[model samples]
Target: MKKTAFTFLSVIVVMTMFLAACGNSTKPSNEGKQGSTGNVNQEAPKETEQPKQEEVKLRVFSTFGGTDAAREAFAGALDAFQKANPHIKIENDVMSANDDGFRTKVNTDMTSGNEPDLLFYFIGADANEMINAGKVVALDELLDADQEWKNGFAPAALNFARHTDGKIYSIPMTGFYEGLFVNKALFEQHGVELPTDWEKLKTAVKTFSEKGIIPLSGPFDQSHYLIEHFVLAAAGAEGQNKGLVDGIEPNWEKGLAAMKELYELGAFPQDAATIDLSMAGNYYSEGLAAMILEGSWAIGGWKDETKANTTVLPFPAIPGGAGTGKDVVGGFGTGFYMSTATYENAQKKDATVLLLKHLTSQDTIKAIATANGGTPAAQGVEPDGLPQAALDGFKMVGEAVSISMPIDSKVTPETFNTIRANIQPILTGEKTPAEGLGAAREIELANKK
Candidate 1:
């Protein structure tokens, strides 16, 4: 165990160093479209009897692998796109998706001034840095110009594509909810019906506790995804709540109390912060816990790992909650992004538009999601006849289009480090949640300044 952990840690360190090295600014100039009116260097047509054709290929760098289920599902769609555009050849490369690792590689590529024609990267949640750095192209013109395709997507999904500047960057890949993963057999064994609110949940958990079963499991490894999901659940159940805290930014305060409350329940294993993210996905298989608060990706992992009688649902409504039991808290996952650099290069720029348009089609998205175990982004591809709770959760978010909060991602990256390390101790009584949150708030405020 120690050896395995050491190896993982070594890889993480290397990726961190690699990403940090990418920040040196020696960027390449944008090559504006060759035939477009936008560039100052637009060339006049030569007096030739026949129009000359321009040749270009789009290079796609992905964090997705060809063998990945998502990629498998998307392969046919991509083949169709290639058939449609003979001029655009796609070269797909899969890189690591560890947050820091992906960031480092992309950062290095951008700083080298040769950004990918398109990035299959996380868009909305992680776009703050990319948008601020002007790495992402503003797609407002492309989107607004396409009234037909623009109306094809649900508005809630499109809302995340907009930057604070009100310009669009990338369309969403797919949306998911952070919810409770249940071991139905365990609840049945304990004779504890699912609890509808947090207090009753505490009772149910305690009942399981007496039988020597851990009631919940989580991974707080770095970003505190487990804890953060609980916060999102509480926030969704609480009126899709956003409040103005004097010292905090837009998303800082909404779910703090709920996170603290869950920590107090002693739900997770000891030293959960030090555990690997993959650990919680195995809980039901190992019989460690009754449930988990996680996203749809768990569906893929669990099906591959175990055959336990398991299911998923939205977090039970918070006691005295203001929102429905099915209220969900997450945004559509990111989509492909065009590079401003590609748009500027006359030869390379037109290739960017062709590929970007093809990648956003309903055909491509549905195939990718079907293979990847997510509910698809296309309007007609929803999950059918699952638990009513799962269906309700999915529909609620579609209707409300709740603001997708990047609990940890929204704060500064430096602040991310501070809170990531401290979440477990603070949640489990070693430190008060208020104190820990205050420490995080301090770092966040400093970063903003």
Candidate 2:
């Protein structure tokens, strides 16, 4: 009986040793729990980790900076984009629209292989060079590939942005209208009638000048709006659209001559020759002047009181000219263009397109239009809280006989600059209207070559 007990105890001891060894083997080792850096962690191996997203940097050049009415709104959009895309960085390169150097800068950058990833500029002649050189991408395919995005834009807006080659290279954000913005309060105080025609305009100018008020708040140097309206008023839509290519239209001469006639009657500010568009706008905004020739974008920059009193009218037709007197200068003149470089770069292509989409999105278009008092390019989205002046301008557009794009869009930059350079000279009698148009014609011919 003692021998049997010893054998049983041995077997029990062996069984206990085997069970302990199995338990120890099943338990995880401290060495396996340690990472390569010898740090203790219970996480999975490095091979199972998610890869980091690649970083992308893009540069977008636009006129939505330096006191532009839409500057803040555009910056807000950029901020929102960055927030949504943490891995992408955007360089908001901008220049003021009023700065003539901005045009030179854009042209220089485009030709010097320093093109911005995206460019916001005029859709017509201003972009033709870049488009022809293939510096910018034709967005036709992109638009077709994304129906949701394509359908978001107004059909007319997209049609207006199409290039001469039957391809779309730009995406419009807003449309604009230029007109005679008259402060009704000033006219009422002076006992003058609204300048709806040439005779009434002359009477108002005479009365305003006699009362020591600037009749028109426009600079002779940066006389873009002045030139546009006068030319449209005299040349009408047909003659203006013909451009200087078919030789100088007689109505164009009449347009420039009318500017001189207005100048001699004390229609401009005394300091108009030295001032720029911004200062001229400020004069009207400050109530120092009764009227200003400006665009829809300028309404937002005026004082609230001035905005409240403002009303837009079609620039009156020049006497004995071809204008219908109801024709106005305006359209989808500018838009956003993506650079060919950015569109072809595989790493940046997607990000740049995304940024472009964000910028031209319906929400963003509405925001920009609201801030700038421009016609939104997105269908079914109207700008809210617009001043009376803006509303009046829209009404004027709606009732217009014809809406034409600005002359600057039809002519080359060099040719237009030549015309602008002659404004002060022509007004002061240093050059005749014929001489000014002749010089511009020469530039236009050379540009075509």
Candidate 3:
């Protein structure tokens, strides 16, 4: 009986030990399955993950919109840049070059700390305020750092764009020439001679007015071209360059007087006092007017027929003035300016600079010059498909006795604004020639003080 009981106990102990070992082996197998599944889950996301690119945005301000000749070309260039860099975005802010309000807007934005990343503006006095306030950065070092970009520009163009302090703050895209753009068809139809001199101009104006055709299409309110040409014609390059800084030049007064003489002969549009430059351009473009005192940039915006029939000439010297009748208002006057804010922004600096370089590249300059008829600032780049009028303008510039920057460049913006404001009053006999010029001189003096 005792042996049988002991045998039963041994059998129970062996069964219990076998069951415990089986349980331990099963637990390890289940844990191994879980560990392998966890490893697979961890490796799956790593295999499919991609790095995300952060997008950048930039704003560029310029006079490349609102019927400007190079509007489409400018848009196309921006499109190309955007395509090349999908990670970057651009906001093209534009205003008409003819709009006086644009100047005010730019000045206000720059001074009020709302400046754009890129600014297309005049290089001389027009930029002085921003430059003096340190709103823009000098690009001399940047240009020097990029050999290809620096070498692409015409040396003369770069030199011409230098500020008074001998540093380049702007990168020139194209140079411009302001002249008398004439529709030869109109002159020929009326049996009037081309306005090669003051007397011929008077004759053409008298004839066109009598025949019910607008003689010279220009706005008294926005009389920029008229003022520029008349002042250049009367004052000549040297006197015009003297500005109102040393008081008003007698020749400047004579220039205003010449404008009055033309006004008396109905040389301007009937609605000249109320019209803006764009309206005045429309008159000439639609063939309602015979001539327009405008810049090379105006050529491409004219009607096809008018453009084909057009020719450019220097404004003739006013009688008894200092002008040689060959002096011209032209040169690399305007360019792209980089704001100090943009240059200092670590996030935007590189991309903004890249955009600037692309815009001012040789190919881009050629494209813009082709559209606007402005002289290309890129070295060895001649624009294709130039109109005869543009070719004539180039020839005229080549033959000019002296090519001077516009009068506004030689004076302060406030002084030029004063001059522009007085154009209508001066034309209507409300202000004498001396009075108009004297007012501008006062503003200039106050600004200088």
430 Cα displacement, candidate 1 (Å): 3.7
Better of 1 and 2 by TM-score: 2
Model 1, 112-200: lDDT tens digits are 88788888776543667777787778887877876656655555566545566767787766655566667777888778887666676
Report RMSD (Å) for each prediction in the order shown. Answer: 12.5, 22.8, 26.4
Q: Which lDDT tens digits does candidate 3 get at residues 135-228?
A: 9999999999877678767666787788889999999998888899999999998899999999999999999999999999999878788889
lDDT of 1 at 431: 69
Ranking by TM-score: 2, 3, 1
RMSD of 2: 22.8
Compare candidates 2 and 3 on TM-score and give the better one.
2
Determine which window of 10 residues in candidate 2 has minimal summed lDDT.
26-35
By summed lDDT, the worst window of 10 consecutive residues in model 3 runs over 26-35
TM accuracy, model 3: 0.88
TM-score of each: 0.73, 0.89, 0.88
Supply every candidate's count of residue pairs whose N, Cα or C atoms clash at under 3 angstroms: 8, 0, 0
Off by over 4 Å in 1: 1-57, 65-69, 79-87, 96-99, 209-214, 233-245, 248-266, 285-288, 304-308, 317-327, 372-376, 380-404
Better of 1 and 3 by TM-score: 3
RMSD of 1: 12.5
Model 3 clashing residue pairs (backbone): none
Query: Tens-digit lDDT track for model 2 on 128-204?
Result: 89888989989999899877778767666776787888899999998888999999999998789999999999998
